[model samples]
Target: MKETAQKYKRQTASRYLPVGAQEITSKIMEAESYGVSTKHDGHFYLLSYDGKKATLTNHGGRVIDDLPLLKEATALLKGKCKTVVLAGELYLHKEGGRTRSFDMTAALDDKSTNIYFAAFDLLSLDGEQVSLDIKALDQKLNTVLSSGKSLHAVKNSFVESRKDIAALYKEIVEDDGQEGIVVRSHNGPTYKIKPLITLDAVILGYAEGQGSRAGMLKEVLVGLCVAKDEYILLTKVGNGYSEEERKNLLKELGKKKVDSGYIEVSGSNVAFTMVAPNQVVEFSCLDVFGENSKGVISKMCLSYKDGTYTANGKQPMASVISPVYVKMRTDKKPDTNDAGLSQITKIISLDINASEKLDVKKSEIVSREVYVKISKGAKMVRKFMVWKTNKEATGEYPAYVYHYTDFSAGRSEMLKKEIKVSDSKKQIEEIFAAEVLENVKKGWEKVKS
Candidate 1:
């Protein structure tokens, strides 16, 4: 009787969380598939739906102020399935509002943009919510997805062929929507946030703004791409292009404003009145939210900011891009370097937690040996291999890596418990040489835990 009473109280408390931050609890989630999801309440944290009443402060409002997720949320919820503890974005998707989606619905205050819950992972399901068993959670999630509810949950995928999907990506981009693709692992219930390496997008036109906006022409077109053809519209931007670039674009685009005003571009169902697709801008962006039929791309940037405007390089203010300006890029076709590893890395950074997405088997100091052009007049030391990719030799992948400058004394302790430090007697003697040498080697540390 005491255990039963305590259970009831605990369940009731699960309805509310402290305001500012939230943490994953020990709740065991059974097997269940997660659709890309969005949290409806702006709150970064939430109370589990206990089928009682709204316990969260905003019961119906958001505390986290998250934009819509770029991917759709889905899951099959019936049958003799295991209890699933799902983790994902919880959002409100107004019912019966196909065209409006999250952005339009929220902004327009359309009641139709009802709340929605899209889980991306199965933390636990069917009487098992493992606190640390990610693999178990993943498997359970897949089991639930097999129930067949995903076909209608949100964005649907029916594989045809890789060639077909690639072609479709170009059509969506031509439509002036988001730019990229989502390749699901047929081997498992996993979806990767991928960037286009050779995709196409329609040309909408350049933005009309100032200062950094001065001169040579650039663009700001409403764009889209594919799944088989994933096309999503990007967001509001007043920065990016320079004034000179804008001017060049105006002069060139003026000639394209046709009698019909409907300028045909690349990618999906996208069209621009004044801007034409004569010139393709190479770049990258972040994938945000998506509707059943549309997708979203945010934080887009030109790979090359120095290149001349293809539109009107000869017109007034047709300033040539400075070489130092690091020709954002211009060597290959716009589609050649579509979204690739670089793109996927960026997207993964945003959607998945560091611990969840990255391989955490062993953490350690990462080192790489590359020759920097030092002053020829200065003494140089023999170079040695510090870090190397096993990919080239062992056919294995490399880890996501970064470096930091350390000038501070041992203000912070070096690598701690769970990881050890080693040095040969001769190596330690060598490291004891000059203070400058010790300083450099001392700073070169790693994280192993």
Candidate 2:
């Protein structure tokens, strides 16, 4: 189950576009034949049945063996096939409220919460990959799955024209309360169409409100990390929080105030009080744009140091559209891998460098040391090199590279190496000292090259 989860995680997530964007949706609707399925607001999981036993694994590699849904699936498929795997959303239904991801998360620990799985795709059957079309796959699921409360097939509709696609979107998304619709082509690309999109970013600053909301925060400035301690200003979110929440956030951010160097306003003439980048927040927006309507890059990158933010003259990757505050993610941190540009690029296709390509300086080697130590008639060599990556100006590369290599003629592997990157000269120097102290012992002799 862990191996299968890792394999699926490597596959690119399906691309998506705004449902109202006729320019993009029109092209997708032109596919020869397609099927539409409701985009459930739930967690993604895979169900694998091996004729005798069944297992369920979430995208994050957690195995769920105790859900009643798993037991039901195993019994239904006992004599049907040797093995089968299906992919779908794991959601919990509410009696009078709409299905939401947050609600599902809150009920995960409640054994009596009635968890359910909506199988959408037939990935494999009888231990062989299934390459059937959407219609064929739907038929197979109907025949094999039969009906059950805890486990069932996701409902779908087949369409051939733009008119039909638009109608389905209206019915499923706007009227039926589903988050969105996913349309899969018979021979082309698959698309996820939605009215709004969500993003996770780090808080950079805040602005005070006025008039009726004068005592609270009016809006919060947010950015996405492009590198270590470097963030690209994305957007300001003002709506979707209560008055009490606004007041609490203002008091919380006041202690983190810092000096602003590049940005000054929220694009609306309101002055900003900059703060440290420490909080990870989730926000919903209508869309994200790499360029403004005037075809100009509208985002800027900044570097933070010693409680200050300064402009870093590098091309920005993106900016948000009409963002609204949602919730704080205490489990996440403001780092490159968590709050990075790849988070946005993974969901939607954007030409971030459409205006102009950026130029970067080549890396310069600053120091090199090679040492040899002879032990018991065998020779072992160690090498250390340090280089400055002036490419940080491009907002795409780290500031320095510390590379270490070790080779031994007597070992089966013969070679072992490690490469580390950093944005601080002092930190890199300390790393160099530590490496030398650990590897350079009594019999080692420095060699000039």
Candidate 3:
């Protein structure tokens, strides 16, 4: 079951609109027919009925057996001759009003009753694998799964030209308030068509690379300037950089390194090297959400001056989805107008949490430790500190932070640091212990705090 779930995760599609809608339309005109469907903002899960029971598993291989809708699915699929597997989205479907992706996220977190499953693909039927075309898959799904109160087929249609696609986009995305639409080519690649939201942001830092990209740029951290020297943490862009661009951009950004008082890490677990906010870059995203999938507010404000970046407070900001690096804007300065926060706010209405506030208090240091190691008359120093941000009530900053700083005068990049934030004391203790075990070597002597 795990292998099956891994083999066919959600089908990711390439974007077509905002950049090359016409070029994509020209390419699609060559194909015979394409299947287009409204893209629902929801979580992807695989539903399976193996004769005796129906199991619903997410992309992470964790089975969600407690969903009340599972009982209805089991009742409908038990009569099938073989084990049936279907791929669909679990979304919030209100009977009378419009529901967005964030609503679905909140619903899932609170176990809301409005959640519904919209089946899109038919992976298996009668215990046999199905490799049908787009139209055939739609037909098979309609024939296999009946529309119930908790389950229904996703809205889809067939298109052979650009006009059809544009009409669907106008009706579904622009008029109907959907996030976007997905079109599957008859026998070729699939494309996701959505109006791209563009923003000019300042480059804040870059996370170190890994694997094949070692010593190169893995991700670029960006921010929106809300005022003359104030910025908000926007997102960590990891895509749209060519292999050559990665090496070249990294070298260019290396000269602007600064000792920013805050730390941010990438999904790959590499620490970011802070840089001066002097460069303006363009980025495009499909959409932005104020809350993450886990129902946590995702907003952080910062103050920058004199080659230093400090956290100001947690304010209202949107977390971008699939942020793609466009280019470096050499003509524009990294100021409020060029990299303004209103660029995003004017386009989409951010769902601001009532509890979110800009109430940042002074961070209190709970513990401090310093260690010294001298070799060949060169002194190397390590400092570890544990502090409470006191802004945890805002749901933006972590309750506790474990910071490790290393300064070696012998190295080219003389100073390196790592920061770990958590809400649990046990986890912080484990992190502090791990750092001590690894860095406190034979020559290192502890200094009184």
Candidate 4:
């Protein structure tokens, strides 16, 4: 089949660009309208169909063959159009209503179902390329695919202010667990805005690649070092590495390779090459999982303990799911990672307490008065006040119950009915000695086990 003269032009968005909600709102207020849509994390493609046959092409306009989704799509659009090209993302929708890129890649081998084409733009119509407006393009695409079951137009909204854009983005990303959003200017080029959550983890090992990347490092096993010379295996991150990055990582791993240690390989097709856990690499992940529904310490690490994987006496390692290798950190050391694990443990304890059917938010240790300290240990202690907005009430209230974490001991405590803001030095000391300190120590003893 012959391709259209108007090929797909990939749009790019940079983090340094002025594409935030405020900037977008300002642009819209200046008589410039923009369409905001969820940027689906999937393969970009342009589907073309003539009266006789249908073909799928990538961003470069080259025809893709033997793909089941494409074939099904061809059948869906076989007689629908004389000649038309639809631009969109090809992805696999999970049963739980999530779009996964890994599953989309697996769909290339006919190993996946529920594959979809999220059509966004109408590129061509009746074998002719036309430059219709965004709204017109959307209307045309929707009209054409009104009866189709597999293909659907991408949903978008027109926004005129920062608040509108922000609300839409939050609804799509945070509430829906989606990647992010893409904002297309009415008369200019398109721009993307997505949240990129990154973390610093120590490199534990490397997994061998297969096929075109065989013999090279396919994925790097990374972990969080909770103590000196102590590390917990997190997850193997393979995506986001370029060809040059893979080669450079191979060289670095060769220099850092140690005796094959506690590195575990979950699959037979991949081999693990153990390395010294000294190099710290930064990774980007989708979302962090915590113990409770409130998502406390959810930014620290991703959990893989869905009862499938375990380590260290059946204890699951705090891992980042769908970790994308970003870059190696030369300035940060492995020991600095302890605070994250400590925070995770603290959140876990809080979650445990929350699971006991306690109203954690309303439960506060009110202080009678504020006091200042001047001692050797005072220099090491950081104090801050947190005010939480009471949605049911008219004003914000201070969160008197504070979390004091001992990173060195890997524990935390939530003290109640102690350390009042109105308490004097003697009263504070007496309270600490009489109840607070001992209660905290006892709390740690329970949490540590």
lDDT of 1 by residue, 349-401 (tens): 22211111212233343443322222334322222222222222211122222
**How would the candidate models be sorted by TM-score, starting from the highest?**
3, 2, 4, 1
Name model 4 segments beyond 4 Å from true: 1-7, 10-31, 60-62, 65-72, 75-79, 201-449
- lDDT for each residue of candidate 3 in 224-343, tens digit (9 for 90 to 100): 887888888889888888888889899999888887666666677545788899999888886665533233345677788887988766666777667888888999988888888767
lDDT of each: 0.29, 0.74, 0.75, 0.54
Query: Least accurate stretch of 10 residues (summed lDDT) in model 2?
Result: 12-21
TM-score for all models, in order of appearance: 0.27, 0.52, 0.55, 0.44
TM-score of 2: 0.52
Residue 442 in candidate 3, Cα distance off native in Å:
3.1
lDDT of 2 by residue, 168-243 (tens): 8888777887677887788666777778778889999888777887779888989899889989877788899998
lDDT of 1: 0.29
For residues 1-449, could you state the per-residue lDDT of candidate 4 as single tens digits? Answer: 22332224323211113344334455433426667888766666677777766666763345665555556666766666687888777777664465655455446667454767888877678877768767777778778887665567887798765567778878887788776787766666666655655777777777666688765668887777655555555567888988888987887786654543122552433335666666888887653433211112211121222212212221233433457888888988876453234533421222222211112233333322222323443211222222221211211122222222222212232111111221133443454344434434321322111
Residues forming the 10-long window of minimal summed lDDT in candidate 1? 312-321
Candidate ranking under lDDT, highest first, comes to: 3, 2, 4, 1
Q: Is candidate 1 or candidate 2 better by TM-score?
A: 2
**Least accurate 10 contiguous residues by lDDT in model 4:** 414-423
Clashing pairs in 4: 367-421, 368-421, 368-422, 369-421, 369-422, 370-421
Pairs that collide, model 3: none
